[model samples]
Target: MKIRFLFILCISVFQFISAQTLSPNAQVSILTIGPGSSLNDAFGHNIFRVKDPLNNIDIAYDYGRFPFNEPGFYLNFARGKLNYSIGKSNYRDVRDFYKWQDRTIKEQILNISAEEKQAIFNYLKNNYKPENREYLYDFFYDNCATKIKDVLESTLKGKIAFHEPVAFEQKSFRTLIQDNLDYNSWGSVGIDIALGSVIDKTATPEEHMFLPEYIHSFFGIATHGHSKKQLIDNENTLYEQQNLKTHNSFLTSPLMVFFLIAIIILFVTYKDYKNQKRSKYLDVILFFVTGMIGVFLLLLWFATDHTATAQNYNLLWAFPLNIVLIWKLKAQKPWVIKYLKFLVIMMCLLIFHWVVGIQMFAYALIPLFVTMIIRYIFLIQYFQRSNSR
Candidate 1:
């Protein structure tokens, strides 16, 4: 009786271990979630899903999870030192969560062999471990979307090939980013101002996978590098975003708001010109605001680890020296007049940069730029007349 009981216990233990392991029939797929309304969700999301019907196991692994409550979270984020971690959860729960957010979800079932599938599953499991989960996140290079392409290549021993899709038009990183955002939206304007010329370079076909939609597109047409076999076996739309009417008022748009501010600045300058006077307070405000913006941009370029904020040409117009010269706006010094002339020259340089495609500035700033140039020219003339007196 004792020998029979031991034999049964050993059999039960072996069965449990086998059941916990991924079966030969397991499926590994990429889940692409459509963009949401908010700026953070504007780029959409991507996740890896592993499903084993034989083992009754379904799990979703995501690389976008960041611990918001961790120490120095906001500071590290600002400095680009924040670490993002992989999170694993029940596949059904993840699907339901994004569905509740009214985002569309699509799944691309990979055509790789069972061995490759098991390898990817094991890779994700090991990556999900607490000591191994965290990785440095880079927006254009090491993001959630890019990880889907990277992980497959890494785990599959570089057997995957991403071919250029049909009628693919190459675009700069900035253009690709702005494609998902409204042209005149505040978010778009902020991106244009905060990021710099580094993003203006044309991205490679594989680099385009930084966006989740591109990941889905590239992976759909991908194939095994060695055998030239199609990579995707099947594709399915799990959920579709509901058609909802979104209202954006023109009055609140960045273009309209900046236009109105330009009109006000021009009106004040015209009045000052007619009276043969300088608006001391107006000069003070413009100098302070533009100077502060220049300082901030300098910080983003030099003080942070952000790759996109380098080589910003926006500093041509927003000169930081203006902050120190605010008190000297009314001075009869000859150097003050020369400084005003220098500002006008900088404005012309900014226009040259835009024309040459060295960098793309915000289109909504056209009105503001025109008025600012006029204002700087007026300051130069006004200061000259004051110095002569």
Candidate 2:
């Protein structure tokens, strides 16, 4: 009985040691998931897959998980104070889940030494701990996709060199985002409206890794800093997204909807000009809606921690003071005329900004801009004439 007990104890220690380390057959790969239908998933995702057949380990670790049920989740998200956590799951489960979602899954087996692979695996395991898992999420600088590149750089200690892919053309962050979204979609419009000129600057080649597709492309062409060998040993498309018919109704699109609203505004202004009267209700609604949007953008720029929301030029048109002065639209005070003239000047400045490429406004807002300019001019003349009388 003593001999048997000693033998079992030795076996348990060997098993524990094996579990703590990776075998020679261990492999680390990056899994790039294709974009989904929603705006949140428009840029796709990245996961680290560590597999060790000898150790019976295959786990997919991702840094995109957030607690939706956490208190103040939505408020924190809005305030840019949300904490994203590392999540681990069986590799097969993640693959099957993305497959079921009809998203393409591409795997790039990293070309690295066994030691480097072990370091990466150990780092991920350590990061998965409850206290270490949570990190401040940044949309551009720190996100699910960028984490893949960050992990490799941190673990390998400058061993990986990302080369610019062939035929690479640099683009601004906003342009890159719009590339993944339909131009006239509401998602695109909202992004253009809320985000400011900070995203209009050209992003560096390395900065492009913020998107998962770029991470895959750049990683495929990366090289080992020391040996200069290809960083990716093999590339495999584990799941190909099915070609599904996507139906987008043009009639309901932002461009079409905004165009219709602009036409109505122009028609009302024309009637007001002919009859020598103003539509106070229409003016009130326009001011209230635009003012509210301006206030929200202001909050995003000043009140939040989002780096991309700074210096937003959308305020040129959606002036927040309009909300405060909306009640005085019909007043014949000279100040009202001055305010209308200021709005007209702001519209011109908006056009100049768009023309000079200082910022790119939503294409859907073009007609609205024109209509707003016309209405503002009309109001300026009408107010001046009223005050003179």
Candidate 3:
């Protein structure tokens, strides 16, 4: 209890000191952290830092902090209603956290006047209040990085003009996201299955600032209002990431595993075809898996508030009706044959969609798609023979 009391007392003193007026030596900077190995860290992070040695004030503001302990965490995340908050932390603690993760950290000192810096610092302090902290988090429009960009723009109030970075080009949201993900990894596959055609549209140059590295590049070249002066006073790397050897298991790679499954399925399918026999187990499992995936996509589209999931075209291949077809395969109903034909047509449609740049499916799906076509064709022939017999 004494330790807790001392901790609380220290925090109170720190807050009191931080709220004091800033001296001329006070500086506000942006900290950009590079990506890490995990899926969650594929995209980098952006943070606001305020330091005043005169007042012994040094703190970092993080806008990506979410209230995971709040009620309905899972439900709200799925419904796209999760709220993130601006969290204040010790600057050294924040730096150490990223350093421990081996992520490179860079800081950009702003060129604004001390008064402007004070105003920005005060605004951040006010925003960190419990009542004002939480904000609706949007992946494309209002993520952690965008919060920093938007906050600076709003606080500066026409005092800054963000220019397009020389290294930037207009790319689609899906392409930008996929650049940080391996084509055959589970994260890539899951994202491809969840998001829809809306992400395929090309993003504007300004829209690219949603990523942290882009924010760093753009802000470095930004100009002061009505003047050609640069917005950044100085830039320096705070911590450089050290090189580390990485080893990935080849057996677990998506391409290797999926191709093996495809080969086995095709071999069994070919044997069944030559013997004029059907593998009821294989058909049941295929229908069940595809149908379940289709059902999940349907739920994400209609039941959830996820905007990017609304117009998904993966249903063309998953085919939700396969759930019912699982049992219907035994009877070899006439309509079931037509349904298999429709499935084949839908696969063709998926390929057309991919070609036309409507939506980009996972590259690992190639082997699975080939297996699907072969098996569906074999099933059609078997059904036709049974109908004739």
Candidate 4:
């Protein structure tokens, strides 16, 4: 009878223990990781770290994870329809991964009542469920950093007041992104090409939290409650990135390659001019390439779900009509000369746009732009002389 009573007592104790909540000693911290050399890692990362030694719970939750096995993964990513999900990982494992990549990791311990902590913890738990995990990933609006911002604001019921960083200054979204990217890098060039004029608008102070570093900065200055109590109890550096030299080959850089191509185009154009002849082959190649690029830009703007590709001004230089008139380049038709003149005008407009900062163009494109202008002028003069003959 005593053994049966003891078993009942043990069962009750186990049930009671299972029902217990997190201890008051529990801490929730924001983990901000520094950027790496890769284009994908240039924007850095944000994560939630929940630590409870008494309950033996130490885990990091990341909203940046996406399933590689999802149907049409590449297709969805290309169309801006990719779904990112919340993933839980051991804190040590996440640290080790960043350490291996030589990226710095920092942490900010959040200050709040134990009840608020519990609420936030419970909310994360609910959000990590399979059904609730997935969300549409947008680079500018709803990325990993923005997710942290939204979650904190939502769970706190608008009590958290995010102040502008001490060094905050209003800047266009494109400029802010360019600060993190190398101007001469292929990544920067591709971004300048793919994204349109929309990102050139000035970002609001609150909107700067889209980047992980901005999130870390703004959250540090954040306050809560009517008394303006501080939201961060402490800040820490988990790892400092090592200063290791990375070798970059200059031969493959954009400036060098584009300059060479521009020189070659100029040399060919000069040769044609001296002979009083037009290079139909050269015109065909240039027109085809530029027209194809323009077509691609149009597809990205119209067919794709990507919001940043709309209102692209690169179309001014790479007009799609160039392809349709490929056959007409051989004839000295009046309309052909008129079309060439129109191209020359569009190039001038592109220059005007660049000078006024309507949209930032690639610096490496200067030589190419000059080359295109000279070629178009030569083509116009050639067509005029041919039609007069």
Candidate 5:
């Protein structure tokens, strides 16, 4: 019984195929399944598609040979191949006044034999295997997603569907996907080149760091210092004449702030000591306070100039020092408060550095700001816990 059904189905398909004439010249509109299969009718016009044999995918449909004269077929028909094919097509639909261009098409047709021309037409008409047809769609969707986007646009009218084939074999479908053969490669290449140019033009003074984003957003380089560390040797003769003087000036400017903060902290501790008398020993406070100063010194060193590469890395040593110091001062409370006050002052200076002249600051303030924030959080947590206790 199953065999009988299969035979009937084959017979029915052959009848349908026979009903369809080889007019490759008939009304060029697409019929969903591809140049050959009719899926459904819309707007009383059929949408065409080419089927994928391997993936069960059906690409968008095209109408027909575009009357074989537009820029698309303009070349083949003008070269006489299309004209000859049209003459060969039994479809009575061939227009009487059809013409081809001289430059793109007419000359090429003279070179091919009639037999070869027929073979070409036959291939376009019948022999385009489902696998090869699969390639066209893959070429568009995978490699030329952009072009596929352009052609699938609505403005071309419904007649463009017939240009597609239906049902390609599995191997052909995958082959097209693997091979990227289209306009995207060029587009990406152009973008990369443009980005390289930006990197060349706008590298930072301290970094001279190559950045690709500079191409897309030219101004990004201006505010681009998310984090940066610059290293420049001060061993040169210019160091003694310039950087040495600059370093000395930086060392002194923060002196007033340091003294003022220290005095206020000492006053607070003295008041606490008087309230509790000998019960409030200064050991804990002194230990914690010294740790804060050590941290502040590192920040000061980094903020002195834009080029602080080694200063930043060497600053990492401060961590182990911090762990040891905190353990030693574990019992200190008053000292911790005084140190917290010192950190608050440094935080203010960090912001000022960002605003005054990041370029002159060489943007060293970024890390200083981060360190101050983390330290500030620790101070806040300690105060909150102490107040509750």
Candidate 6:
């Protein structure tokens, strides 16, 4: 009986040993597919195995525009859903932005004028409100960081244990920055919404304040096994060359808040006037026009703040409801109006944003241009004819 048990135990141990453990500095293997000789022969394989950044060759399996620090964990292991980068220039800008941070964000921010430093400190004091910063960071990290870690730990457990601390080195690492509405101190706060901001280590990592710092730190951990501080200072020159500053990116974030309020009033008043007149024809056309505008705002929200971070913009359903109110202008086809309203409600539950950010705002020009062409050709001609007569 003892001999039989020993043989069984040995067999179980052998079975366990056969499962390979990935090395601490091993490449991050991501699967892809290629054309097969026959339809049945097609298969997915680990095609893009990311090289360790610390290696002499320094190969980057670029994650491109996806926001998370750990590409492997964010793109593959977590949910199998992918946020693919569509534009090459767009992807390169984002990549270069982070690479700049990984290279020299530390000393760069330190070189700011005292006025800028004081301004940031003052802004943090007024805005973050102590616990709010950490609370928000933890909130974001809970969704963005912790989930990725769980996937990594869970997927690699028993197969590979993390021997090195899963944190970035603090020495060579610096906070990467970009121009966003919320953190726009670099530009005049009065205008040009996409002004830039970087994390100030002088303060406790605060949401909006500290979050950028952790982003740079986490990105280093994700890309290079080295901690944030461990990255080589010499790499920063390559980073500097990549970031060619041109005309600054702009956004109208402040005006948008006020714009929403004014439009709501305009919509309500117009509907009320039409209700008394029972203008069925005008109401019908207005519904389609307003719905298009609402969808336009949502597209900007998604493009700017990113999908994972777009909870605030999700509440922008008010834009579509304006269409329903246009229908309530007391038309015979109230059913069509009600249907449009319902559709608007459903979309509101769908769109989301991180609340504080910038957008192409110009992306609005797409729908705007289309609608304007129809209006100018018709309305402008009608006005000219009336005046001529």
* Top candidate (lDDT): 2
| Cα lDDT tens digits for candidate 6, 1-389 | 99999999998886554322222343332212221222111111111122223332212221123435655644342332434221122223534544544422221111222332233223323323433222111222232323223323343331222222255233210121222222322222221111111111222322222233343333232321322232212212223323433333334443343345345444544564445323344445555555565654455345443323232232233255556555354334435444545544444333222123221112222232233223223333333443455
| Candidate 3: residue 97 Cα off by (Å) | 1.1
Candidate 4 overall lDDT versus native: 0.88
Please provide TM-scores, in order, for all candidate models, with all chains considered together: 0.96, 0.97, 0.93, 0.95, 0.19, 0.29
**Per-candidate RMSD vs. true structure?**
1.8, 1.2, 4.6, 2.2, 27.3, 17.8
| Candidate 2 deviant stretches above 4 angstroms | 1-5
Which of candidates 1 and 4 is the stronger one according to lDDT? 1
lDDT of 6 at 159: 26
Write down the worst ten-residue block by lDDT for model 3: 243-252
What is candidate 5's lDDT per residue for 183-203, written digit by digit as tens? 123322222211111121222
Pairs with backbone N, CA or C atoms under 3 Å apart (clashes), candidate 4 = none
What local lDDT does model 6 show for residue 328? 50
Worst 10 residues of 1 by lDDT: 241-250
Q: Of the candidates numbered 2 and 3, which has the greater lDDT value? A: 2
Model 5 residue 150 CA deviation in Å: 58
Number of clashes in every candidate structure?
A: 0, 0, 0, 0, 28, 17
State the C-alpha lDDT per candidate.
Answer: 0.91, 0.93, 0.89, 0.88, 0.29, 0.32
Stretches > 4 Å off in candidate 6:
1-58, 65-80, 83-235, 239-244, 248-321, 331-389
- What is the C-alpha RMSD, rounded to one decimal, of candidate 1? 1.8
Best by TM-score: 2
The residue pairs that clash in candidate 2, if any, are none
